[model samples]
Target chain A: MYSKELLKGTIEIIILKLLVENGSMYGYEITQQVKNLTKGKIVISEGALYPTLHKLEAIGVLSTEIIHIGRRQRKYYHVSEVGKDISALKMQELSSFLHSLNQILDFKLSS
Target chain B: MYSKELLKGTIEIIILKLLVENGSMYGYEITQQVKNLTKGKIVISEGALYPTLHKLEAIGVLSTEIIHIGRRQRKYYHVSEVGKDISALKMQELSSFLHSLNQILDFKLSS
Candidate 1:
């Protein structure tokens, strides 16, 4: 498991990109998909996940839809048009930041 | 330039790794080294830099040496034994986090 401190900064970008790729996802679905994709190497806790989702929605980068499956209501989140642009921008920033970090860490570039 | 939000989480790891690689460095020198290393792609600002340094010192991961260069005094920082171990741990965490992030970002793995 990764430390919370290590995971703190990148959570927003992770959520943004996941929404971009998946089109839309509910909170539990997002968590499950992350586990599926990373093979359980990373997990997003409810405490961290919900607040970030709400925060992104508050920032206008995400919009939610209420879906009724049987009697339960699930909030599904999708990127807004603005959210798509923000995801692209944030992805670029994440790419560059990781590049710089790799260089600093002296990790052998696979290329 | 990356957003402050993007840079916030990684700064500590960056500082710790630089100290590990360079042995010891002063604040100005560390900032310059980061610019030199990343070729100005990332700049560590004074406002963000000092408090982190002081925080790391308080946390026992860093120790300082005061040196006089002509008329000026400079505090040089080096990793404590604990800091070195922390650097290694943080670097590993960083590597894994980046890998997971890339998978989420759909960045083509160079491998």
Candidate 2:
């Protein structure tokens, strides 16, 4: 399981990347996808997930569609073309961070 | 300059990493370091920088000290030991992101 404190930054990237891979999905579906992919290791609470999703959508990185599914209206989020481009850069930025992290971790482990 | 929309997630990592490199610094210093390091390409505004700093400190990743400098007191933030470890992980996480980003960008460019 990821640390809640650390997870705030990670969640946004996961949301964007998931939308890039999946055409569109609603909040519950996104929540489930994360849970299932992590083998239930990461359980996303509604409080943390919804606000981040809402903020991302508000910022135009994601576009939402309201669809009637069964007895209720569900909002599905899809990545905008701009979101895809940003995702690409975000992915690169993360890789850079990982390299630095590994170096620091290894150095610490050795010392 | 980076996109404000894309910057929210990035700023946290930048703040942590800067603290890791430089022992302790205040809000203005953090902003200046970012600007100077980027050769003024990236300017961190008061709105974005202070909130993130406070949030990180609140989360225990950063510990702040109020030093009397000049005519007033300035709060200087240093990474907690935990923050350093997290920073290391964050660096590695970013590296992983960059690799994925490069792959996506290259594929897009070629296609």
Candidate 3:
């Protein structure tokens, strides 16, 4: 598990990207997907996950659908049209940032 | 330049890694180094950089030395023994996080 401080800024980007790719996903499903995809290297806690989801929804970047899943209704989140635009923009920003970061780290490591 | 929000979580790690590799560096030098190393992809703003440096110093992870050069005194920052330890730990955490992030993003992009 990574430090919360280290995870703070990237969470929204991750969620946005995941939604853009995977369509609608509920909170637990998002957490599990992250874990499975990362092979257990990353785990999003309920504390951090829900607040981000809520915040994204509140900010008009995400829309929620309550679906009946067996015993209860579960809230599934999908990227809004605005969210899709934001996701594309954020992904580009993230890609460039990560590229620069990799360059910095590789230069430092090689030198 | 990336959004300040995108840069928030990763700044300290970048500084720590740079200091660990480059020995001691002053503010402007660090800024310039990042720019040069990243080929201008990443620029550390004074507004964001100094507060992080001060926070790290206050927390005992960094130590400062004031050196007089050409009648002007410049404060140079170096990782202390404790700072070195923290840097190593933070680097490991950052590496894992980035690895996981890449996995997620790559999967999304490929699928």
In model 3, how large is the Cα lDDT of residue A2? 75
RMSD of each: 2.4, 7.7, 3.9
Worst 10 residues of 2 chain B by lDDT: B102-111
lDDT of 2 by residue, A1-111 (tens): 443444545566777777888889888998887777656655668887899889878888889989996989999899888888888787666544433333322222111
Candidates 1 and 2 compared: the better one by lDDT is 1
TM-score-best of 2 and 3: 3
The digit string of per-residue lDDT tens for model 3 on A1-111 reads 777676666778888888988898999999999999889878888998999999999999999999997989899999999889998888888777777887666522221
Candidate 1 overall Cα lDDT vs. reference?
A: 0.84
In order, what lDDT does every prediction score? Answer: 0.84, 0.69, 0.83
Where is model 1 more than 4 Å wrong at Cα?
A109-111, B109-111
Ranking by DockQ: 1, 3, 2
The model with the greater TM-score, 1 or 2, is 1
By DockQ, is 1 or 2 better? 1
Q: Considering summed lDDT, which 10 consecutive residues are worst modelled in model 1 chain B?
A: B102-111
DockQ of 3: 0.42
The TM-score ranking, best first, is 1, 3, 2
Report the lDDT tens digits of candidate 3 across residue range B1-111. 786676667888899889998899999899999999888889999998999999999999999999999999899999999999988888877777777777777622221
Candidate 3, after superposition: displacement of residue A75 in Å? Answer: 1.6
Model 3 steric clash pairs:
none
What is candidate 2's TM-score against the reference? 0.51
